[model samples]
Target: MKRLLILPLLALSLIACEKDDDSTTNDPGNNGNSNPSALTNNMISVGTDSTSLNKYSAYVATDVNTNKTYFDIFIYKDDVLDRKQYMLLHLTEIPTASKTLNWQSGANAPGAIKADEFVIYPKVNDKRWFGVYSVSGYETTGTMQATVNNGKLTLSYEDIELADEFISVNVTERKKCSGKLTFLLSDLQGLTTTAQTLDLVAE
Candidate 1:
């Protein structure tokens, strides 16, 4: 009789263990190491010396289920105060350590579907307005490379040129507006939050 009771108790214990294991595996709170959704809400501001030109901002967002990544860049004209240019890129995966991102144009690109890519929106004139020069012409070209190591992020841009009409922005400019940024990422925990603004001065 005691053996029979022991068998039943053992069976119950095994069933409970299985249920606990299943519950842990299916838990929604288990977001591995990164929360793409949270990361999407974060924003990074890139500052330049040309205060009257434009202000630049970048964002990293992702959908883990679909394994899709969204990179967004915003250019706001300080003087206009009513118009802003936006550029967004969609990729198969979020940039974790290091990767090269290509520029995509058109109305069908990743962020394009949501009207988040290559768009200009009107804004109300406000004293706090800031902006970055429009790089609309070079949308089809250029590469963005980034690296993350030891909690430091390095972002570099290459071969990014301006349109003929806007050539003056580059002419006689020794820097040519191409440069790399290096900053600490201690504040950007889990890569889901925004780090502090970094200088993006040309050169």
Candidate 2:
């Protein structure tokens, strides 16, 4: 009985030691790599209505079960009327440098988003969500340029019009919104800081 107990104890100790030694993970988000943003205080300026969607915060997660890394910017206040509005930017790859990629997130509107597609989804609380696509030959014309460093982005849009989007959803239009606006990272407050300067071209 004594021998049996000793062997079990020894096995348990070895297992615990191994776990301690394996504390490190290969995840770029946790291993000091620029995979997911560690920066907080995120804000997005909706250009159309000239009403900035700076009502909340930004959330970051990594080592996802799906193995995808991305950050979210809250465009609407969470728990406000039991509603949550946010923008989800699913990182397509670990960007080594900043590039102005064509806005393709909502390209597959009224359909499933492509696996390789990089999109910014403005998610509403209900089943109805909307996607703003930057496709060519549309009445809407604009370009988005983004810079990602440490998983933080500076997204800017120039004179982009918001037409009827996916799922037959037109929240922006129903709300009467359109025009150029820049989306960037800042402290998570649904309201933009008054001290911060804004460009009023789209208005």
Candidate 3:
């Protein structure tokens, strides 16, 4: 019985030693080839009013009152699985004096005087999206999120957070700088996603 007990104890010790060896060999943190996945989408600016929207590189909006054109500016860049860059905007540059202004987030309209505007600091996860919305009380706000997918950067969001406000005049209009963007793999360079600098242009 003593011999049997000793045999089992020796086997247990050998197993423990093997486990420790395997743990050290498989340690990804200690491996020089291992890297933590981190990427960020940098937001430069968004076009809001007539002057800001006309020079946008993505899309164009038409002003009914002046029969002119406008463009919104949105620029973001990230390197996840691949190098991705995008710029999209809706061309609508009507003055805030011809239509009733109401903020719409997703499908619901949040009565607000104006949609909030802001920028998001670059971060990495998998995907990232940012946009402006009209919240309660004519309050405009912005939001951003990061998602992971096959180690790629493909994320987007465009549902407003409506604000509480009512239209008082026909000239009330609000231009929410909200849109979607995704980066493609062909834009990347190495195994690790690199940092990309995007330019901010207005139309």
User: Which candidate comes out best when scored by lDDT?
Assistant: 2
Most accurate candidate by TM-score: 2
Q: How high is each candidate's TM-score?
A: 0.33, 0.36, 0.22
Q: Score each candidate by Cα lDDT.
A: 0.30, 0.31, 0.25
By TM-score, the better pick of 2 and 3 is 2
- RMSD values for the candidates in order, in angstroms, are 22.6, 19.6, 25.2
Off by over 4 Å in 2: 1-48, 53-85, 94-96, 105-117, 123-129, 132-142, 148-152, 167-203
Task: Rate residue 145 of model 3 by lDDT.
Answer: 28
**Candidate 3 segments exceeding 4 Å error:** 1-139, 161-172, 184-203
lDDT of 2 by residue, 9-58 (tens): 22112212321111221111110111113222233323322323343233
Model 1: worst 10 consecutive residues (lDDT sum): 19-28
lDDT (C-alpha) at residue 42 in model 1: 18
Q: What is the lDDT of residue 168 in candidate 1?
A: 29
Candidate 1 structure quality by residue, lDDT tens digits, 1-203: 00111121221122123211111111111112222222211122212312222333334444334445444333333321233222222333334577665444533323332311222111112211111134453222345565677666545543243221212242222111233444344422322223112222321
Q: Which run of 10 residues does model 3 get worst, by summed lDDT?
A: 22-31
* Shift in Å, residue 182, candidate 1: 2.7
